[model samples]
Target chain A: MKAALRNPVDFSQFPDANGHFDRYGGRFVAETLMEALHELNEAWRDCRNDPEFLAELDADLAHYVGRPSPLYYAERWSRQLGGARIYLKREDLNHTGAHKINNTVGQALLAKRMGKTRLIAETGAGQHGVASATVAARLGMECVVYMGAEDIQRQALNVYRMRLLGATVQPVTSGSRTLKDALNEALRDWVANVDNTFYMIGTVAGPHPYPLMVREFQAVIGREAREQMLSEYNVLPDALVACVGGGSNAIGLFHPFLNDSEVAIYGVEAAGSGIDTGRHAATLCAGQPGVLHGNRTYLLNDEHGQITETHSVSAGLDYPGVGPEHAWLKDIGRAQYVAITDDEALQGFHDLTRAEGIIPALESSHALAYVTKLAPTMRPDQSIVVNLSGRGDKDIYTVAALEGIQL
Target chain B: MNRITHRFQELRRAGRKVLIPYITAGDPHPELTVPMLHALVAAGADIIELGVPFSDPMADGPVIQKACERALAQGMTPRRVLELVREFRQIDAQTPLVLMGYLNPIERMGHAAFVAAARDAGVDGVLTVDLPPEEAAEPIELMSAAGIAPIFLVAPTSSVERIRRTAQLAQGYLYYVSLKGVTGSAALNVAEVAEKLATIRACTDLPLGVGFGIKDPPTAAAVARIADAVVVGSALVAKMHELADDPERMRREVAAQLAAMRQAMDQAGMPTAFAG
Candidate 1:
């Protein structure tokens, strides 16, 4: 893979004109709630510069969510995949068992700072719901989560965890009874309660400030990995890889390294069956440009502009669209988007579990699947850092059922 | 004849149920779209609703979404769909054709350009999903100038004031969304739709068409009893998907479904002369 196109925009300028990421992101929300989003953006901009805010977040991450998770060298997996040396950033070991808590905690603290009393969120695989609930309890705020009716059934245990954490989980039955429906319901709720409530969006998706904010909180992953690789290998990795479902984890691991001209950023999408089968969630690799969830991004929509169904082995990555930032990154050649089929992801899953003793979430398995392709071509001295976004505990049952291996 | 007004008056005078079959213009295959329109008319379609595939249809269900996907995968475009309509006009000039879709494609094509192109293509009306009657004044004026009826939707959740406003702005038949959810959702309350239709009747004299849940012949026939027209979408779209590999089979099955609805509605009353 070649080097990524340099991102011309500087982070120091913060919230570029029209709130865009090089003409990709902006406030494309409903008119009734523009003031609310604007207020949020202003508050976030102030907080980013405040040392007190950053210090509080750093303390919470250290004592509450357990930051500085280990960087594991997957020696066995590297040999098996015949790839360049593979290193895993252990975000999956973070509190709440996924990278979602990283953003949720940061946003919850911001919500408290903004004097908001209630917090609301939308979840797809229930990971974000659990993370939000966990943080709301810690912050002593009222939390409400909207989930698709279908996801509620599929992830019943996480739904129970959310309830146990003193959060209200509302099931959305609109649209396809999936993530998009939950998002629509959450948006309706946000519009209705914009004055008193804070919407803690789970991923680097949504209208504007959200994608940028979530990415900022997640940038820690890349910063730590870059520093660790420099100390351990005495050189920059040839490539950075992460799974892209709404692109939170990917953006987290990609942003800090955007200025690194020598590093290649690869966003691996979940191709449930295959791209040709029309059942995959590889939006940028196979889809066209369209507006979805208030963002002008690439979506798997039909000619009539109706959103199509998407499938993936990982419930978390099964959405039909990717984040708008990812779309823009691909357009500018800042990143290369590829897809890993369900079978290949499964192979990656089993290989990681057996070789590295790390049972990765199906979502993270997408990145592992990409390494299997990129490793054999690289020189032995080259390095690839994979953001292990989440653990496999929540996905064990799903993977077992697919493999006909009863737990 | 002013086909739209004449058709509405004819259905009014006869007290017969109108059969409006919706088909995406380039669905399954673009080359087969015009022939499918002719086949549908031959199988007893009174009005043809040609869906112009846009990139986003917020109100449609999964079945119609898939149909749009197949058409788009085959490289179907709005211009290609209009070309199909122009070809359909060559054989059946009198049957009313309505281009149903969202505002973006029309906006992207430019409202003035769309009206001009549609008028030239022999289109009689349009039903843009997102364009409320409140925001429809300018586009309605543009369409009306081209002699194209600007059809509008009246939902059951709509307040009486909104319904009255919608009725006043709507040109052809009023489209009454049969349920509270998007297109293809289950749980249709025909009684609720009928009551809403009656409320709308107090505001305007236009014919009302009930859609969004008319899936089968029985449901279509039931809706036809109270409303002037029944719009069947998901059932027909599902048929297209089931037969996407075979265009001839898709056309036959779709035409058969429309013919079944037509036959069921025909039993309610007989055709009468055009009152206009």
Candidate 2:
């Protein structure tokens, strides 16, 4: 039925004035960061609307980060499944080999316009760290990235890439020694040095303007996908699928299609081991509403409200908290959240590489894993577009270690 | 009246500056926390800030962060904290105990339930580090209704507008983060704090307590000369950590430090600008 366009509620008006999407998202930092957040919010507002500022961003997106990544139809994979036709939104093709560079470039431009000379970021898989380092190097700004000590070991390749790009990678030894710890350290750095540093958050999380700002920057993904679908394929896909760690890439794709009633949105979270085993990063799938890392969102916490340690084969999807928008989307039934176990995700990783000659990032493999199940449930006439958020080159070590193959 | 307000008023009438010492609940050992509180009161704490250990304390430096780790390792939760407060109330009911921590644990405990439980446990005030005044309306209302004061923090980066807004919502007292960084950070500048307090004083008449980097007694005395209260946290917590294997020594040493600050603050009296 063509009845999808009847309701047409505007999804762009989110985060109200207070940076809240209904009950989620708010300024939940120390007072030291309140004014800094307010300043960043105002600057983001001005830069997002200013023609010259946007022009610079667009030029950089074109010449520097390589935007408008191809939308490829997965013919062989779809026919083999004997279900819905599948397409891949190739964010993996972007510079730095991931979708993370899109938001980093935009935030870097804003930081330059705001006269900030230092950039600080936190990373899990180190893609965002590398992306932040790349932009800071290009803009002649000093960059420092906080990474978990464990991740510094797991993602040594990206860590070396970041250092090679002239960014200092500070190892965080606090908390669970992963992405969440890295973020806490980064926030501490921001609080201590709020005067001159711009915190370039890589995901659609954090305080007020960040979830909104990162979403807008990443919306270029959905915008391009929408245009390509209309101009090339003549219709929107029946559903959209993307991995949700902090829900950056997923929200980027889902935000543009929120008003499109017929398009089903599925946010895939990493269920390390399995949800029933009480070890997973499937926040929206298993968590309750709570605040952490500067914003209120769905978080994996114990009965005492302490954030639980999460396990995931994919480092990027190992966060205890998902973005507030994803929480709101799940609560409002705008998007369906599902989880893929490590074994299933590994299978999806191998399946994509063997069938499509594309070794998807372990993070993106979670989405492809969901697509493998959901595509077969739909008709052959239907279509699905999965965001291949990053390439798997960074995950080669992890995959090889798992397969017991020496490099 | 709330115990916090009453205590501050009594201190003001006595021409004595308030000394608030913070210690993480369940640190070193959960059994030692109540005894520690008593020792602090005997030493000269007009009000006490009990630190609720959170797994992730973003606003704390290495000192308090490690303190929280030790406490949480001993199985400290919001409920356990209230139980500790209840036990402390059993012996000492005069000293106003303020529960200080991040907001997630309380949010998990539910605002209404946490407030009521806190009130019943004899807690006088609550200072959630991450919850600023703008997002504090619900908690403020709940805490006020429960006769517990909702404390707020004012930072060096806080503008006049934010100070005014926070002043309106703050109950009992205002916690002025004396420096721009987290707790246990280096070097407290008294001149800078005094200048910022003057700006904050114009916004509200709430009692202003200076924290973050008030290390030794001399620094405490310097802060006491300008602020209504002096809150010593990291230095005291660090001392507790050093003597964790021996609870009695830890309590005695912590008491000595607080006693020294109390003596220095008494000698310094109150700030002339804020003197009645």
Writing each residue's lDDT as its tens digit, candidate 1 over B62-127 gives 567667657777877777888898998998988999989766456556679889999999999998
Q: Superposing all C-alpha atoms, what RMSD in Å does each candidate have to the true structure?
A: 9.6, 1.9
Candidate 1 structure, TM-score to reference:
0.66
Over 4 Å off, model 2: A1-5, B270-276
How many clashes in each structure? 6, 0
Instruction: Kindly list the per-residue Cα lDDT of model 2 for residues B1-276, writing each as its tens digit.
Output: 988999989989999899999989998789998889899999999999999999899999999999898889989889999999999999987899999999999999999999999999999999999998889889999999999999999999999999998999899999999887889898789999999999999889999999999899999999998999999999999999999888888888889999999999998895566754
Could you say which candidate leads in DockQ?
2
Q: What ranges in model 1 sit over 4 Å off?
A: A1-15, B1-276
Candidate DockQ scores, in order: 0.06, 0.87
Q: Pick the candidate with the highest lDDT.
A: 2
Query: Model 1, range A285-378, lDDT digits (tens) per residue?
Result: 8887765665557877665456777888787887877777888789878799999999999999988999988899989999998888998889
